[model samples]
Target: MSLGDEHDGASAGGGGTGQTRTRLPDSGAGDVYGVYGGARRPARNSRSLITVVGVVVLLIAAIAFANRSGDGDGDGSSSDAPAGRAAAPTAATGVKPVAGKNGTIPSGYAHDEQGAQSAAANYAVALGSDGMFRQDSRHAIVRAVHDPAVVDGLLGRLDTAYSGAFLKNVGLNEDGSAPDGLTFVSRTVPVGTKVTEQTGDAATVEVWCTGLVGLAGEGSTKPVTETWFTLTQKLKWTGNDWKIESSSQKEGPTPVNGDNRASTADEIAGAVAGYGGFTYAR
Candidate 1:
């Protein structure tokens, strides 16, 4: 499900310059809310800058202390951090993982914490993909990623979520295809995942991700835009593997604006075509 885009100068860098960001129309049901991208700003006065720097230093110190003091006792309490405190696992767990896919989506994950985290990450990619706009692919993805009992309910809800109006708003045809000569863009890139709770049969995971959604065509009105979100999925061990029992999403643990220059539409399309996505594993 990887459709890579090359970005010029995109980074969560030190700020103080003006930035231009594209605002997309709302494209789906209430689940997918409109989000504003970070814009550049003018530098602040010296006194204000000093205050900001002081606050940032204190925040960084607080976060470091929290992580070190986190309840690593394996009792699974106090696992979910407050907003802005959840950090990505800095190192790989080196655990053996799922060996195959149920279809295009990964399946057969190990029945443990790392497996649950990996399942949640990959499911975020599948559920937030352009494939969800099409019936066949959407059904396959839901079946592959979600618990069987909830598939029908989710499909119907998702059908309404990605309505014709939503498709049109995002620069797709009624059938969810890009018009001739245009390439639609919808991708989710997970930054990392955390398991908030776990048991022998179930786990709760949060995936922090950055995404791109819109159309990549020369004259497209809904040009590709980026979004930040955290997806929380409740997973259950089912059919000898992990499946999503329920899911919800929220806006972000969005990082500060990066100073990288945005790539052109043509560059985006070319990069997506040139680079393929991965079947993510942890």
Candidate 2:
């Protein structure tokens, strides 16, 4: 079947939809606080501060306990290990591919939950990268990550989604061009991943992601907005590899960050142009 046909099937049976869903605002480029006026900073209170501190301590302790508990089933392979212990490379040593392969695609995933997490994380990075700004590159990315059955339909819809108007709304000029002397960047960095459910051949992986999306140009209206999103992929082990059967994204499990210095356009542009993406592995 074509990509759109597959999307229809997945949507029909509610197969693609999962427990976690992304709540994206309809106005993709507008600020959520704009409708309600600018966001008001909450006033500080000593009592409130103390309560927050206490909660933080409890959270930390809970995290520590979860890590120590190793709640997930531990097979000989490291992929099924719990998130707490499976997070670090050392703990996840057995699951890491012998070496990165498939050009930029990480290979040798351990055919387990950890492997699904690794795939989901890397896929999120690929899906949200600046490469999606260009039509040709975007097609390549979707084909590479999506199951073969859905490639054509996804390509068509994505072509519409990344049309001239959408590009302009994303602060790009017509034909996906950036304003002179500026760069447009969109990338998702995975904060963590969890296997909500998994069987041998089918698995559901949710990647909690922090993304930066906007144009890095002087006088730009949207200057590098940050967002948190969770991407859940229903994966199938096909042809000796884990391929995305279907996936969806939703708003966040977000935490506010303290104020920090913003970088210059030059810095952001240089970093993006100079650096390259890694071949992620389990």
Candidate 3:
């Protein structure tokens, strides 16, 4: 079974990375895919805790781009030669290297295509994170990433979807916290991003992601595991930045299992705490 199947609500941030957005290529290199202000999605053909969690995960997550300067004008550089060629006036984001935060999530993205991709990439992290398990953080995330128009309705639905009963089934306490000795993990890291469609006011982006879910430590039935999925986010220019409109997800472009030895729960927990998540999501 897939890692995310049994555990509907997935895991965290603070792992290694930055992701540039682009959809997966047809070659099976990756499979692909939002945030809160997000509209209530139309009922899907398939529905599960994973599906709900996947969609919800995108609703809260964060982003980071390695080669690109997130702080500048989308120009290749901060000051030097306008970073190769300056963006055409119509396309120039003027604001790059997104800054600030919305609660613990990233905020203040540029107003261009790259910005949309970055916002989607980063959002997936929040969506698939451990935050979804708890009520307080979950509410804050919904407010930060979602469009204000849909937030009220979407909030009610999400509360029902992530009920205490659901959390218990997934091995979490009713409060969405891990068992006293266990470490819960549910982090989604974007592999890449692609813009499938775009217009002046909106964009549809696909983010291919690798996610971690489950728990670690003694007596834990839900061992932390990995997952692959693609998420599609419908984004709109709202309140000066891209916010979620609607979203969807589907399984892999997953790779074959590798030869690497799996880590112990302690090791996994250590890694989660030691490493840092990328900054682009903001």
lDDT of 1 by residue, 180-232 (tens): 87788777788888887776788988778887777786887667777776767
lDDT of 1: 0.61
TM-score for each predicted model, relative to the true structure: 0.71, 0.70, 0.68
Candidate 1, residue 212: CA error in Å?
Answer: 0.8
| lDDT tens digits by residue: candidate 2, 38-157 | 112233333566777887899999889877765444533333534454443223544445364544556546677667677777776776666666777766766666677767765665
Ranking by TM-score: 1, 2, 3
Residue pairs clashing in model 1 are 2-277, 9-260, 10-260, 11-258, 18-40, 19-40
Tens-place lDDT digits, model 3, residues 124-181: 7776667766778777766787678866665555566556655665667898888898
lDDT of 1 at 156: 58
Q: After superposing candidate 1 on the true structure, give the runs of residues whose Cα lies further than 4 Å from its correct spot.
A: 1-92
Global lDDT of each model? 0.61, 0.57, 0.59
TM-score: the better of candidates 1 and 3: 1
Best by TM-score: 1
Model 2's lDDT to the true fold?
Answer: 0.57
Q: Which one is best on lDDT?
A: 1
Q: What range of 10 consecutive residues in model 2 has the weakest lDDT sum?
A: 31-40
Q: Quote model 1's TM-score.
A: 0.71
